[model samples]
Target: MVRAFKNTLIIFSSLLFCFAQQEDSLKVGLQSLKKIESDVIIISAEVRSGNLNPTAYRFSVFPRHRPSEVYISRMFFPGDSLQVVLPENILDADSLANIASLEPVGGSFEKSYKLFSKQSDVIDLGIFDVKKKSDIVKLSVVDGQTGSPVLKPTIKIFQLGKVLYQTVLDSSGYGRLRIPIDRNREIPLYALIDTDGRYPLWRGSIEVSQGVSSITLALNSMSLMIGESLFRVRSDLTPFRKGPENGSEILFMLSKDDHIVISRSAGNKLYGRVRLDLHTKKSSNFFHGWIRTKDVEYLETFATDTNHD
Candidate 1:
């Protein structure tokens, strides 16, 4: 009986030692986590808008190059504010200049804020006015050459790199785009029209006015002149030069994947035009300039017919 009692006591002592070690390890781990959390940068903002629901929107913070490391805010109530935590160690100095965006769950519009590099721990952005989707814009897409409706076209409206609205047009090439209004005024946005790869993509900036309801877009068709060939910019920051040579002055810079219509070519240089704005009137809003041949790739070419007017 004495030997049995000693064995039982030894087993109990060993179990107690193991539990104590585990408890110490857990406490160390928690301390390490707390330290890490304290080292992060927190961005807090109160969303202010009529009929605002905290659960219906989300806040995101991420580096431009490292989108996978994006930190999103958790769902909170109306009175509680939204907070986004960005770890300092994981991001470099350049990545510290991140982008903070607020978007709705249904994706009506996205408002982006550029975060400057600051050493502060907590950055409090005062009441952010979230725009509500209260206005409607009617669009009519037609063929540029024929002046007839382009049936069943797909339309996508973009604002700050996010698709604000997407819809397919009806048989009459008409679509009503529902978008957000800011301060009861007009806002500049982008529009992209696709016709199931039948025609070249029509992309241009547009001004959405508060009271204006309708706009028309004309898409150049494949039956047009061969000089109207479409080309897409192959590199970012491609300069639109005033002349064909490298020594020419740059009118503006074009982003990668921007489509342009080539009008002419002068040895290794191409003269093209990009649509700057889409208007309801027939007057053109294109920016015509010269770009290097190496900076763009041929997308499509229409048939050679200069007689049709």
Candidate 2:
């Protein structure tokens, strides 16, 4: 009987020991895992590389909810450690409908971060200010470090949520984006560029600084061909600027002679929209430009910021 008791105790103890070992092993494995997230006036998302290469890559931050899909595609890199800026207005959060506190990662890429020769923290939106002859969008970027300006890496602009203008900067590291304002204002403008991964180095919301003096509407440059109609906003207080460019009836005859200036652009090719001046209430004219390889090249080559390069 005693021998039987001893055998039973030994079996029980062995089982307990094996279980404890497994628990300890699980704890160690958990410790090896890393978690990165934050709340408040900031966002830190894991950068997943859907696709990558020496010249370009596809990347994005998650919470993709809509037709936008909101991703970074075709990110050009010079190859280096990159620094990115969180757009001041991008703290967009929504109360979850009791979805899990944290969304479980479906899957992830191999590398946590990447390095490139040319990385950017500053956002240089390539645009032409056609608003007033002197229209300008003044933007400042803070490096991953203190509020210093990183002088490398080029900034590209994606309007209406995609790239339309792109320019390289000079030694000063300042990029001048001229809306040259002659496009559709119906859609909101979204800026994007990769700092290191496949996402914007910097993104933000900007508007014409308070008065007419900040920007000038270049009326003389307005050339309406193909019966493009220019529309004028009835009011300046509201962001809604309606006219032909804003999706109104195109009165080709009335729009031809009207001189409209470029306000902002949202996209490229047939998918793009341009916001024009608000002065032409009677016309339906807006921007219709070609953004081929040559157009992209012209903008990049003529970039005012390239003096240093």
TM-score of each: 0.42, 0.23
Model 2: runs farther than 4 Å from truth? 1-134, 196-200, 208-309
Model 2, CA-based lDDT: 0.34
Residue 150, model 1: lDDT of: 93
Considering only N, C-alpha and C atoms within 3 Å, which residue pairs clash in candidate 1? Answer: none
User: Which portions of model 1 miss their true places by more than 4 Å?
Assistant: 1-134, 159-162, 180-190, 194-214, 220-230, 255-267, 271-282, 285-289, 301-309
Q: Write the per-residue lDDT of candidate 1 for residues 21-117, one digit (tens) a residue.
A: 9999999999999998788887777777665543466677667667677755465555665876777654446634666666655434446465644
Strongest candidate by TM-score: 1
lDDT of 2 at 239: 23
lDDT of 2 by residue, 1-309 (tens): 999999999999999999999999998776655211221122222322323222322333333243144422233233322223344334224532111011112232121222111112333222111112224554443343244554543556555666645665444445565453444555555543333321113333445432232311111122223323333212212222234244543322212112222223444311122334333322334543321111211212112221111
